[model samples]
Target: MPLIYAKDGAVATFTIDNGKVNVFTPEMHRELHEALQDFVADPMIRVGIMTGAEGRSFCAGDDIKTPLPDLTPHEALEAHFFPHIHEGRTGLTRPGWEQDVMRFKRLKPIIGAVDGYCLGQGLIYLLLLTDIRLATPEAEFGFPEIAYGMAGAGGMTRLAALIPQAVAMEMLLLGERIPADRALSAHLINRVVERTGLMAEARAMAERIAGHPPVAVRLEMEVTERALDMTRDQAVDYAATLFRFQRVAYQGYGAGTGFFGTKHEAAE
Candidate 1:
């Protein structure tokens, strides 16, 4: 397998194998999926960092030469293939690696460490999913689908929501490669880091996120994904249920002071 996973203090690191630019083969994709599911189910685990070993960036996307075999290669090879997450519009008639994307959506906090060119499916892997993006100073990102006369169908829909409209349009329309700083300015990436300190920053961030209450973190991520599509009032209304009056954590009382309180009264 081209993907390698390791853990340190409630945080898991999934490193794409260095050879072939950490591309996702069938086994690699399966590894990524399993790693995600493993971390998702393990309550003790707090966060995950996806990166590429022996490189400055994360992954370069799927290796078409040796595509993942879990599903057919036809859907994977399609130019304008994607699953609609809005209004129940499943566009294409072909079978999607639904289990993969759906399984991916279940992910909470995954930070990307981009080192080099993240092309094609690699671009899709970075954008449509990962929570935080840590791009190295020397790293560049692009969806070269247009270069090959194809569209970034996998992640184009998400571009509008990830960054400003105009910038997203420029990226999708022009299909030109942009550096990490540009991505950061448009809020496409969370932070920019030096190539030398890439994984360290990602690991530190993962640790901090892991320190938060797991239940609350997981629930917020799960709910927010669905809530983002709603209108403002609908958004508010939908969010209200998450703020149930019964949960002492949301009752305006300090944590551990209301119901879970024992030896320490939560500070006001």
Candidate 2:
């Protein structure tokens, strides 16, 4: 199995194990989609951790060795128009698989444990999918696709949103690898630690997140992501509505206990 998924308590771990650098393949993407579906559906799993099996790389990127079938102009148009119809077609190249994975709408948070190279599609995953990230001092982050004459728009948009526009442009345009410290300075990753303590640190962060109230955590994730595109007034209104809804649900279940106190206790 190129992708290994395991659940321990409230934390689900996804380990990419293809080759030494853990480059992604179509099969691995399929496996990841299924595993992610399961992870989202399982209410017991509150948080997720994504890492590479070997210490060499979290994921270098897609496997360029896999041959893509040549499509006629009409076939390309058809595939682009009706993606679901051509989804199962063998030998057909499925572009935007990473985008699909990132757009899964899973409210649960994922922590990225980056050890070595996090480049190309790997960098996309790190930027969009993972809420929190920890990398080793040896980790290198970049988007090398520009050099290959292919730049992923989704990655570019997310990268620009994550860090400063100038820094993001420098990375996208130069196609040069940035070390862990540089990445940290750019605010791309949370922390850089020794390789020995990477997973331990990631797991500890995951455990801390999992210990929080599940509904609150989900709402926090959902609202924060949604608020990014919302106007200030709209975001405030939306957050207030969700907060009231959550409070009502909790009170209906006779579980109004909060960080402060229950409504009745507060009234007293």
Candidate 3:
């Protein structure tokens, strides 16, 4: 009827619970945004996972038709949808709906456990909202906002920043739904899994990330975000001194750095 948003330890999941298609309504958006805000604020939560109930959809996008009139007024207002129409755009911040899509500067990473039929704003959010996108082989991604006579403002710009130019053009102009394998090949998705093990693999990934030094990862993301807008030389100069950072050494912040003080740092 509406939607479900729940948090468990370092993982918070936002599920599209409005029937099979998972249409984005106002309430659904509000609930999801609030849950994400909570996850972002929680020092104990290091990862967030997004999923849907069942069938071929993480979310099918906005409701194309009006709600059924047979039910009471409350039925028509059961869910709070925002992606389609909200304070995220036009510089407007409605009650309980903050500008999250562009301000997900949380202390943790958000991961999307993508499965079938991720379309329109759903794909847009997956492209920008999630730091890591792990898709099932059965998953498909698209942006059909143009077909609805509206521009996919977020996906239009964010997809290009995330993926190559050609792939971004294909998604923006042609309006085709790309499969998971294709998406992975284009670097649109980070990992691909068999449909049968999608959730398990995603949870495992979340757990692995959650087990790492939380503050380091958070600062890494934040610093890199700042670096993205800097000149190459400037970014390089800044990175030279990044290793001296010791704020993450506080008690309870230990991921032990493994053999090298941090998973990401070791990788570097």
Candidate 4:
């Protein structure tokens, strides 16, 4: 199998296992989407950890060795626009329109554990969507699309919001490789650990996030993602409403409706 799926308590793990490089193929794309959908539908799994097989890279990006899909214009539109709907039994189990990137942005949180080369479109999309990213010191990051006379798509457009525009442009325009240290300095990743400790660190982080109330975690992520498109004043009002709604809906959290509580008093 190109992918491995497992669940441990409230945490779900998806490991990419297509040889050492773990290059992305068409089948891998559909399998990964199915695995993620299974994770989301299961009420037991509250958090997810995405990593490569042991002693291998997270992903070396798209599999250039494999041939690209050849589809007619109408077929291409059908594949993109109506991936979820199928005409017959043969199409029933096909992967839906929910691409990995789309699934990554959904309700649950995901932690990315990167050990080696996290490069090209596949890795870049994952890196941007992951809530928290842990990488080894030797891990390399970049979008080499410019070298191929192309530009990064999908999550690349959101890079400027996450990191400095100059830094985002450097990778997008120059196709430059960013070392782990540089990525950390640019705040592109959350933490950098040794390869030996990367998975342990990622799992620990996922466990911590999973320990939180699932409703609260999902709503908080939704609010945060939505707030990115709002003005400061609008975001404040929107968050206030969300806080009230969450309290009413979940009720597991207190109903006080006071998000900040009393102001802190400085020591004299």
Which pairs of residues clash in candidate 3, taking residues 3 or more apart in a chain or in different chains?
25-80, 25-81, 26-80, 26-81, 27-79, 27-80, 27-81, 28-80, 257-261, 257-262
Cα RMSD of all models vs. native, in order, equals 6.6, 4.1, 6.9, 6.1
**Cα displacement (Å) at residue 27, model 3:** 1.4
* TM-score of each prediction: 0.77, 0.90, 0.77, 0.83
- Taking all chains together, the TM-score of candidate 4 against the true structure is 0.83
State the lDDT of candidate 2 residue by residue for 1-268, as single tens digits: 9999999998999999998889998777778888999999997898999999956699999999987666778877876665434556644365535546766678999999999899887887777779999999999998989889997644545778888989888998899999999999999999998999999999999988777767778899989999999999999999999999888777776654542234343222
lDDT tens readout by residue for model 4, 27-47: 776777778778879977878
Rank all candidate structures by their lDDT, best first, as comma-separated numbers: 2, 4, 3, 1
Error of 1 at 241 (Å): 2.2
Instruction: Kindly list the per-residue Cα lDDT of model 3 for residues 5-53, writing each as its tens digit.
Output: 6777767776776767677765565666677777777666678888777
- Angstrom error at residue 266, model 3: 16
Error of 2 at 109 (Å): 0.4
Clashes per candidate (backbone, < 3 Å): 9, 0, 10, 0
Comparison by TM-score, 3 against 4, better one: 4
